[model samples]
Target: MPIIVNLDVLLAKRNIKSKELAKIINITEANLSILKSGKAKAIRFSTLEAICEALSCQPSDILEYVKEKE
Candidate 1:
């Protein structure tokens, strides 16, 4: 996928655990795992907002786009 999920990096930088982030965002650890692994097809805006708030980060901090070489 061109879009890369960088949730793990952000979590590590903030010294926050995935389980704690899940609780703060009111999401299940399983769901957060799916997102962290870049398996989620889509993310709700509300969920994104919650994550940003919990991590004290911007959306760009969690997501990135990389052009694939052709």
Candidate 2:
């Protein structure tokens, strides 16, 4: 996948644990795990907004795009 999820990096930078973040974002750890692992197919805008607010970051901080080498 070209889209890379940098959620774990941001969490570590903020010294926040996944469980705590999940609670703050009102999401389950299992779901957050899926997102952090970049395995989630899609994320709702509301969920993204909540995560950004909780982490004090922008969406770009959590998500990135890298072109795959052909």
User: Considering every candidate listed, which one attains the maximal lDDT?
Assistant: 2
**Model 1 worst lDDT window (10 residues):** 52-61
Error of 2 at 16 (Å): 0.2
Tens digits of lDDT, candidate 2, 1-70 = 9999999999999999999999999999999999999999999999999999998999999999999999
Clashes of each: 0, 0
Against the hidden true structure, what lDDT does model 1 obtain? Answer: 0.97
Give the lDDT of residue 37 in candidate 1.
Answer: 99
Error at 7, model 2, angstroms? 0.3
Q: Give stretches of model 2 more than 4 Å off.
A: none
Candidate 1 per-residue C-alpha lDDT over 1-70 given as tens digits, one digit per residue, 9 for 90 to 100: 9999999999999999999999999999999999999999999999999999998899999999999999
Q: What is the lDDT of residue 32 in candidate 2?
A: 99
In candidate 2, the residue pairs with backbone N, CA or C atoms under 3 Å apart (3 or more residues apart, or in different chains) clash, namely: none
lDDT (Cα atoms) of all candidates against the true structure: 0.97, 0.98
